[model samples]
Target: MKQQDNRALGAWSRSSTAVLAAVAIALFGAAAWHLGTVALSVAPPNTLSRHYPRWIADHIHPELEQNWKLFAPDPPQGNGQIEARVRTVNGTGARHTAGWTDLSASDIAAVRSNLLPSRTDQDLLLYAWDYYALWHDQLPGHPREARLMAANLKRTALQRLMPQYQGQRITGLQFRFRFDRVPPPSWASPTTTDRPVNQVLPWWRVQNKDCQGL
Candidate 1:
């Protein structure tokens, strides 16, 4: 009976060890499969394993996911400024035209002689005016794009100058831009010089839909 008991105990020990070994082997196999797939997913496009990587990237980091400009490119060689005027209507329908306000000058003042303020006034806000002018040149040919550009300008101006017109009820607004094209380098041909281009966009009635609150 003692020999029988010992034999049973030996059988149980062998089975337990076999089960643990199988679990370990399965875990290792799964880990290897995961690592191999991730490695293939991140491999360069030219490589043979790039099939999965390209597909994966299409799903995750698509081509249009980010705007990528050329490295260390020359800056834009032009200047643009936007000015807007407004007409305010009061009780009994009396109208008054507010003189043209230079929105670019205000933006410049915000970031001038200050270190902590962001470069937005110097580059982004100013560049936005340039974009607006470029869009204006396209005109009816690209109406959608032009409208979007106009919307952007209106939004920025509204945010910056809302306080100034808080009490008054503005009835309409007109916008215009002045762009000075930078002259070519001294060595370049005589065809291109500093040419001043003035663009006066059409007057747009201040609709309730055009602004957050007018």
Candidate 2:
């Protein structure tokens, strides 16, 4: 009788542990699913708003449109903007303000001319471009390539920025992209809080102002 009771107790302990482990796994899975849903809701997959022009378009209901303001906006207005500032070593090895600009093709060329003229500097600039491209969704070749480029750009940008840090640290060379909702024209304001303009425009309409020409 004593032996049977001991055996039963041991079996019950094992069963309890198994049940607890199963419950823990279920809880973890639920949490993971919830987090994934939230992320998807905030930033939908494959929206043009989430990627650059010229990349593969997501075939969903709303296609993405390209805005030149991303690179070279005339008077500059758009969701994607790159602002670059540079500091460089002066002849006396003291740091001086090199320059700053919104990153257009011209701006990129200027930065290359001023700071990264050497092979090393060129490499760093390439890295920075790749890094920016990844965020812009311009990288479509290979995931590995994008990853490598982002890493290299971060490393090179930091290396280039470090030598020029004077008593005042180089504080503000940053890149950011965001979603901006266009406000309704005065005529349409009374009807809605949401802007009437399409969040994603067609590819043809992106750069071209005349819809008829498109």
**TM-score top scorer:** 1
| Candidate 1: stretches off by over 4 Å | 1-70, 134-143, 188-191
Task: Name every residue pair that clashes in candidate 1.
Answer: none
Query: lDDT at 53 for candidate 2?
Result: 26
Q: Which digits, one per residue and each the tens of the lDDT, describe model 2 over residues 1-214?
A: 9999999999999999999999999999978755544444346464543454222222210223243465774531223333345544445556655454444443346556784355444344543653546543754655554555554444444444444443444433443323334554678644434432222211110111211221
**TM-score per candidate, chains pooled:** 0.58, 0.27
Top-lDDT candidate index: 1
Deviation from native of the Cα of residue 35 in model 2, angstroms: 17
- List runs of model 2 lying over 4 Å from the truth: 1-12, 15-96, 99-128, 137-156, 174-214
Q: What is the lDDT of candidate 2?
A: 0.45
Worst 10 residues of 1 by lDDT: 59-68
Alpha carbon deviation, residue 20, candidate 1 (Å): 30
